[model samples]
Target: MKKNKKNFETKFWAGFEAGNPFEASDALFDFAHLDYYKRNLTQAVIYSFKEEICSNNTPSEIFIFYKAIGSFLKIYYSLHKKSSKWKVKEPVRTEDVFHLTSLTKEEYDNPFTVFQKAFAETAFKDFEFFLAEIINLSLSPCKEDWNIDLMSPYIHLIKMLDAGELMRERGLEKIKK
Candidate 1:
């Protein structure tokens, strides 16, 4: 059983590296298979956000953070708009997710301050629940049986988010020199 599991994982990674979504999806029909993908992908995105975006003190740091997170929310909500349990009346826009425009100049300047304000708001709470639902759905043991396709969008979004983070890192380096 362990050897078979390893074989599946090996195939999954090969499919992933080869950019063959169908192959990858095929290899992820089991709970352990899907969980492995979910854990690694989620960690990568969260780790990158915490280390790269959260730690940055640049003037546009807050904007970058919002853009990344808001992109996730926008994509998640858009994909699940009709069927999502967390029914958002309006579309999730990156700019509107944090209500950053309403912030005072002082709050705008400090990314931490902006985060504090946003974190305390209802929007953030909704976002938290929405995120939790995504995580839970992704890890569902019977996810492969579900008619609704969820993983593909998440996989695409993860790649896009990673690319955006790489670009942001390059831009930040340029700003420093």
Candidate 2:
């Protein structure tokens, strides 16, 4: 089992290096096969890799994140379904974290549906602001240790845009320097 897991990782990473997005599915499968108890902080690492390092497209990544997080959230969601070992500690539901499921099979049935409901259930203000900041503006408010800091430039860029002081008109290269 251990050798199989290692080989799975190797093949997945090799496919990643080869720029084949389809391998991401096999990697996702290998990822899902892990014992939940052993996942620990590695869950975030896997999630962030799927969100950032593995992808070069920002909106595409966000689409994947949004489209997949319901499945992810449901891992914590089933805990509160009245048949689990865990309990919901917070009455207020937030997207980033919650106490519910734990990556069970039920959560994997249809991830996109979960995300659609999640997006619909979320307050528009929260959804829109996050979309503007993270999507339109390209920020990483959803920080996980494996990813880079995207807030500083996002902040500076939004400020400039809001104030109508952007330098893109001056030149695209000017934003970095």
Quick one: best TM-score, which candidate?
1
Candidate 2 has its poorest 10 consecutive residues by lDDT at 165-174
Candidate 2 lDDT tens digits, 1-177: 333211212232223321222233333334343223123223333444343432334445444433232222222122112122222122132342222232223323222233334434443334334333344223343544424344433232222121111111111111121
Best by lDDT: 1
C-alpha local distance difference test of each model: 0.34, 0.29
Deviation in angstroms for 110 in model 2?
27
Collision pairs in model 2: 75-101, 75-102, 75-103, 76-100, 76-101, 77-100, 77-101, 78-101, 79-100
Q: After superposition, how far is residue 127 of candidate 2 from its true place, in Å?
A: 9.4
Candidate 1, position 51, lDDT: 23
**TM-score (all chains, Cα) for each model:** 0.25, 0.22
